[model samples]
Target: MHQPTVQDFQSLKRILRYVKGTKHHGLPIIPGDSQLCTYTDADWASDTSDRKSITGHFTFMGPNLISWFIKEQVTVAKSSTEAEYRALSAATSETIWLRHLSAKLRLEQNIPTTIYCDNISAIAIAKNPVFHGRTKHIEID
Candidate 1:
């Protein structure tokens, strides 16, 4: 910020224009079933510079999107399955936090939260109780 450039000014103007254009847009939270769910995915090694994966997930309460995020993974994953599993881990943490919040608000969830993932290998790894050699490198925390 000390040495502002022309590109920085142009970027600021572009952001302001986008904000002004979408000022009328709003997120609607429709009241419905209290089923908590999340859909998670990852683009493996999408960043060519660092070879880090991109994690994205959407957490929903019933039909309303309650939480979502897109971020670069802290560690590099060796495969697409690993990337997706990491994203799922993040999403699960978010879902647990939301569940606790809902419980405190007197909206305790009766059913278990569902997590949807596109990667079959990741799903299989999650379902398996034993951590095989393939996944032994992953940190457990």
Candidate 2:
């Protein structure tokens, strides 16, 4: 900001205008079922620049969308299943946090949280007790 250029000033002006335009907009939280559920997926090596996978997921408190995340994977995944498993892991973490928070807020989730993942191989890997050599490289917790 020491030597701000015209582009910087224009960008600032545009941001301020957007804020002013959406000042009255707000997210509505309606009362309904309190079950926690999440859906997650990832695209393996989708980024041509760095060849990193993109992880995306969204969580819902009953029928309402409560949380979402979309980001590039820190490490390159060798296979599609690995990439999808990574996304599932991230979503599971988010679900755990939300479950804890809900419990504290008196919205005790009696039912277990369900995480929906599209990749059958990733789901199988997660459920299997025995780990195979192919998934040895993945850091599982």
**Model 2 clash pairs?**
none
Candidate 1 vs. true structure, TM-score = 0.79
Give the per-residue lDDT digits (tens) of candidate 1, residues 10-117: 999999999788877867768898888999999999999999999999988889988999999999999998899899889999999999999878889999999999
Q: Model 2 TM-score?
A: 0.79
Error of 2 at 110 (Å): 0.5
User: Candidate 1's C-alpha lDDT?
Assistant: 0.89
- lDDT score, candidate 1, position 115: 96
RMSD of each: 8.8, 8.2
Quickly count the clashes in candidate 2: 0
Q: Per-residue alpha-carbon lDDT of model 2 for 9-95, expressed as tens digits?
A: 999999999978987775666798999999999999999999999999999998889999999999999999899999999999999
lDDT agreement of model 2 with the native: 0.90
List pairs with backbone clashes in candidate 1: none
